[model samples]
Target: MGLLSGVLGNASEIEPGKAQADFAQLLIQGERVEKAYQLIRDSFVFTDKRLILTDVQGMTGSKTEYHSIPYRAITHFSIETSGTFDLDAELKIFITGGTHIAKRFNKKLSIYELQTVLATYVLR
Candidate 1:
């Protein structure tokens, strides 16, 4: 997301890691990482069993906040695909514990891929 978007709560995808580096250390046994992205200075990671959000705080990135949400916790989600008049796609998710996450994607991001992940996980 652009600087303006960032301040406005806009987020961009973090380039996925090559070979989908193992996340077993971060995930419960048998869970796997499906995708990863950087949202500003934070990390947005999607896994087979949950979504992991990593936020770095402090001017020097001295603090880190890790949020893990299981698929079962996702109560609702919405997606807006890029269009002729729209330069970016957006996603919003509402989950248990009153948690809400929203992010903006560049026009090049694949809506289908994201849809698949949401459908298979959140809808299961």
Candidate 2:
């Protein structure tokens, strides 16, 4: 299963308002810890499948496609309670990697947005 699916499965009972607040905090701090694994996966680098090339022999190269390759990072995260009964949790993440480019591209979204989107998906 995908990274988001795994995290959502673990967070099935998460409270809505609490989740939203936690998510907002996550965005402020960094990409949510829960979403970090997926972010890495989604941001994996691979050769462009659409790249075209012709060999010297006048033969066309085969279309090649690859997905999800591991990259390294120095990452730290914290999970804290945001509400009573442990129904709310906030996650903060800090990551640095020489080979990782996702953060540079700013492709990640706030946890609040991710939570809302997940909730919507579940409802549907």
Candidate 3:
């Protein structure tokens, strides 16, 4: 009986630890996402360059798709907090010609990858 009680107590502690880890991961991911978005948005040029984008609209989808044709691609970025735990981000981009390149980033990423991606985008 004593061993069973000890095991149950340990198991209960496991749940809180797992939850804490999950929450911590969420925070980290959120920060990464925000940083990536900002990097992309800041790199865009509008007036200095002639950019035209058409058919821009937000679509209803599983991963929050913001689609635009001519795909100017993230000229402006803003992060808004809808709730204590919810974040909303808006982005504007100027699509050059008719080509829109889409890039996807993972939240669980290393610092090296983050730096590389930002550098690549900004330098281009």
Candidate 4:
């Protein structure tokens, strides 16, 4: 349960003014980030124009992949609150062209905030 425990404890909510410089560097010139969440080495950033998903891979964290999903392409998203039986809350994004992205957060994280943030952006 060592690895499982570590994975379950990795939901780090990124607060304003505490975001990493590298994450901010991923932003475009006029883009602005409203919310961010860090999971171990990976992270998700919600910007004014789109959502930035960063995947950091490799043994030494040398590789990085950025996924930019425009707010217009986000058709809908769903949030599953964690329960006593299931200790993980999940947020799923459904984009255009039938693409789906899911991120799981620790039970302590506020998934509803994420939902509201996306709704404000995507429904605009």
**Best candidate per TM-score, number?**
4
Poorest stretch of ten by lDDT in candidate 2: 45-54
Candidate 4 runs further than 4 Å off: 1-6
Model 3 local distance difference test score: 0.27
- TM-scores, all candidates, are 0.80, 0.21, 0.18, 0.85
Q: Write the per-residue lDDT of candidate 4 for residues 8-72, one digit (tens) a residue.
A: 75456777455545566777786677788887778788877888888889999999998988999
lDDT of all predictions: 0.76, 0.30, 0.27, 0.80
lDDT per residue for candidate 2 within 1-124, as digits (tens), equals: 3345334322222343443353352233432222222222222111111111111222352443333221122243334443443333444433354332222112222446443433333334
Task: Judging by lDDT, tell me the better candidate of 1 and 3.
Answer: 1
Candidate 1 RMSD to the correct structure: 3.1
List model 3 lDDT by residue over 1-124, tens digit each.
1234333221111232333343343332322121222121111111111221122234532242223221124343222222343222222233444433332222222334333433445345
Rank by TM-score, highest first: 4, 1, 2, 3
Largest lDDT belongs to which candidate?
A: 4
Once model 2 is optimally superposed onto the true structure by TM-score, how far is the C-alpha of residue 116 displaced, in angstroms? 25
2 or 3: which has the higher lDDT? 2
Comparing 3 and 4 by lDDT, which wins? 4
